[model samples]
Target: MKVFDKYILKSFLEPFLATFFVVLFVLVMQSLWLAFDEIAGKGIDIFFILKFLVYLALMLTPTALPIGILLSSIMALGNLSENYEMAAIKSAGISLKRVIRPLIFLILFISALNFVFLNNIYPWATLKQKNLYLNMKKKKPALALVPGAFNTDIPGYSIKFEEKYGEEDNLLKNVQIADLSQSKGKIKVITAQKGIISTEEGSKYMTLTLENGNYYEEHINKSMQPKDRAKMPASKATFKTYTINIDISSFNDDDKLDDEKIKEHHGMLSIVQLDSISKVNKIKYDEYTKNQADYFFNILEAKKLYKYPDSLIDTKLDSVILNNFTTYNKSIVLNESIQLLKRTIDHNKNQKISFKDKRKLLNLYDHEIYYRISFSLACLVLFFIGAPLGSIIRKGGFGLPMIMAIIIFVIYFFISKLGGNLSEESAISALFGSWLSTLILLPFGILLTRRATQGMGIFNIDSVLDNIQKLFNKTGNKTTNL
Candidate 1:
């Protein structure tokens, strides 16, 4: 390798490694903070927590890589330019392109590595992280319950509360519980003004004590008469104190922690898996839509209506046809038609919702495939942008370069998120949404590179002013001649 190439490589590598780890650490810590509630007080082992962090860092590597590249590229080139090394190289007939050639190849390799992480390591880490987090939550189910939302992490109960406050965070206020253990022909509900949760060490049961509560139960029997069922046989009672022991043995099983039962999320799929699943789902969706259309058509007897001759289907023929039928027959026919129309309307409404949900799911899969490709290329794209902007700005270190890198990255991040959201809603095609940020930034990068190479500022303000002055001069001359 040439001495200059080695120098450039060393300069870029130092900042790249420093910035990459810094960005990765920040991202991992941010994720950990967001999930602190789920992890804290769950009795998770320290080693288990470390493993989760490793998985989290692995999962977030692709995300942090591009930002790291952008910031470091800016800083590296900015330092060279600020130190007059860029000018010296330019004076010595070394073009900006030649100076960054080694770095360009390096960035390309990093982009490929980023793709590998996105395509393989990301999915594995996502699966492991999700399963581990689920197991942690299940380890102590009481800690999983958050106020104001239905908590179904427990086996046979749905618990909700307006408030949970106490030194141990076990006391609840305005608690409601739905006992789904009796899944056969019986329903029980309990509501309380206050409640307390207690779990003993090495015990299989958690005791819930409710104060000033109402208990309601509804019973249904297959042998009961229609009239008896219509009456809705039920029981109700009020109690100052009520106690229920919930069996939590199933959730306390440590062996299940390593089990990978939940692996269907799009994030947990590779590009090949996503493409295969998306194709299959699209075919199923099309078939479902076609079947629904055919079913509704048959239910509405549309074929029979269309089978009549055009002459007999006219508005005048409608009156004649009704006149031929007796009034009683006419009323029965009209009532049946109205009911069918109502049924068709209701069916269409439901089908619309079903189709929307299916399409959204397909969009998610499609977006993931395209997003992986686009995100991997972001290292290359952002490098072009950051390196050029750094050269033009002619500043080094974490001062101006850091600010510029952050602003550019923020814009890129916002566009990516917005595009993904729109894609998920079916407002835009997944392919377009996934590449939207790249498409938007590529031109800016090109423009910056061109300007920096030509020794021009980001905007040619002097040229604009000169053009305006010339225009004014022409206009004044024309006015004087007139």
Candidate 2:
């Protein structure tokens, strides 16, 4: 029995490793291609390049694990079926169920690993990836600009250098900078024959190492026509060692996260934790709670605007309806104080409304907040579906199962993305939006595996089509007989 278990385990390991490698390669290759120009052109080191790919691979592993399992399981089982190994075991009085037990245990172990990944490692990796992007964005453009090229990405500036040296890091000769930094927004064209980039206080600034550099700058709001502005333009400064601060733009808006925990809290926290923080820390929960609250507020707000009585003079009717709306809306939303701020912004945008009324409406948005927590936990739900599915759909190899896994996983990914968005905008219940993809795919996987194990055949899309054809033929024959 131990030998049988070992054999079963061995049957899966080869395919499992193969699928994992393929998936990792696919992920790293895609990201490397996307970042190729930046890495190669910008003189980025291999260490940084490797770190970027590693973070990306980590983020993608959870997304790819299910597909790996599906493909690997299919390859392993299909190989077994092709060799008549299953038949032999059956002849020896061993059920297919018993033969597959060790393999299922292996899958269970993998599922546990996936659970840890989804909850902890994945979130950390993705967050790191975001931060990396942010740091790149805030880094100096001059450092990234290729010598002898028209570099225009810098803020309110442009540069072109005559030469580059040291392969990656060297000074530029005959450098020209179009600096538009005056009250009149004039352009200062500075030409330096020789210059070197130096780093000080953790910031990069260009230091003109030689004299003989002509300087042209534009003054802001100069009383001159277009041609006159060019000739008699703004204040231009020239110096041999004019050290200027490198333009460092702030991080990208999405990446400028103040709270790492909030961004990552999605894949963490149990239902009880969700309820606990949501219940206790009304103020502290605002960062994460906003999404769920949006769900409830959206629904309640819809009810208020669209659910008005048909008759305008129906004061009694309006009074009761408005009261109901107010009550329900207030129950689920964040602090009503934020409502006052909303009303102010709305009023400024030519939208006249009562702060009292708007705040009352906005008070009911908490339902949407809790919905995201529900969605994050559904990763476990997907694992359950992915497992038995791969087992039942034992095809020739990874080819068929891989396709199926991609289709299913993409659908799952898309549905959650859509639901999470709609939930934020109040198009669906928070719980429903978060759990929508899982719920939809759960029954589908269940139905598919259920049919497979019941002698209906695994992934028998062929038999299904064949049966439909036969049924049509039968109906045609019956009509002819009639």
Candidate 3:
């Protein structure tokens, strides 16, 4: 290697390593903070917490790499320019492009590494982190319950409460429970005016104490006729105070938690998996759309409605088809037609909601496929932007370069999030949404590189001012002549 190439590589590497770890640490901490509620006071082991952090860091490494490259490139080049080393190299006939050539190759290699992380390591980490979190929640299922939503962390039970408040957050208001433990599709529902929850450490049971409640159990009898099903026997009991002990042995069993159960989430899939699933989903989606269209067509009976007999081909028909019927029959037919139309409209409305949900799911898969590719190239894209920007600004150290990096990265992140949201809603194509930020910044990077190489300022403020003055002068002259 040439001495200059080695020197430049060495300079870039120092800040790159420093910034990469710094960014990774910040991201991991941010994730931990967001999940603090789920982990705090849950009696989870310290080692388990550490393992979660490790998985989180692995999952976020690809995101941190690009930011590190951007900041390091800016600081490295900015330092060289600020210290007059860039000028000395230029005086020695070394072009700006040649100075950055080694860094360019390094960034390309980093980009490929980022791709590997995103395609392989990221999915693995996501799967581990998700399952590990679920296991943690299972360990203390009561603490994981949030008011106003059904909590199914407990097996065979769906629990919800209107409010959870008290010194230890163990008090519940308007508690509702759905028991699904029976083998023969039997259902039991319990509602309480107020309830208290208590669990002991290392215990296999959690007790719920209800103050004022009612229990309703439905008796299932498949042998009964359909007409009698609605009137099937049921049992209801009211109590001033009731206590129930729930067996939580399954929650303590880590061996029962299967990691394979959660591999279908978009974050847990690789590029190949995403592509394959997307293709299958697209086929199913198309088939579903076609089937719906066919079903509605059949319901409308359009073919029958438009059909005419050969004898009636040349005859003038009444404007209303019911005109040939007697008054009583016409009214009856009109009422039936109105009722059918109402049912069709209601069915269409329901189908529309289902279609929208399926479309959004497919959009998520499509976005992930393109996002992996685009995000992997961020290192290269950001290097071009940051390196030239550093040369043009001619500032070194963390003050100005750090601020600039933050501003640029914030803009990029905002655009990416916005595009993803729009794409998910089907307002924009997934390909366009995934690449929007990169496309917006690429030209700016090229412009900065051009100006830096040509020894010009970031923008020609003097020329813009001159044009404004010239426009004013022309306007003044025209007014005077009038």
Q: Write the per-residue lDDT of candidate 2 for residues 1-482, one digit (tens) a residue.
A: 59999998888788878888898789779877876555343434455556677888987786666666666666676677667776676678886567667866676667667666755676677676666644543443334657878777666667789886655465777888776544345356778887676555434344335446777655534566776654554555667665556544331222332224334243334344445544554454454357545654774575686677657566434476656666557654555657855764664454223323333223223332444344444444544455445545545575676787677668877987787767655577666776787778778766755664454564578988999999999999999999
What is the lDDT for 326 in model 3?
91
TM-score of each: 0.76, 0.60, 0.76
On lDDT, the leading prediction is 1
Candidate 3: what lDDT? 0.89
lDDT by residue for model 3 over 199-252, one digit each (tens)? 999788999999899999878764666687678788999989888888877656
What C-alpha lDDT do the candidate models reach, one value each? Answer: 0.90, 0.61, 0.89
Q: How does model 1 fare in lDDT?
A: 0.90
lDDT of 1 by residue, 236-338 (tens): 9999999999887765676667778899899999999999999999999999989997998789778797677677446355576667889899899899999
Clashes of each: 0, 23, 0
Between candidates 2 and 3, name the one with more favorable TM-score. 3
Candidate 2: misplaced stretches above 4 Å?
31-45, 142-207, 211-277, 280-394, 418-428, 443-454, 458-482
Query: Looking at model 2, how many pairs of residues clash?
Result: 23
Error of 1 at 481 (Å): 4.6
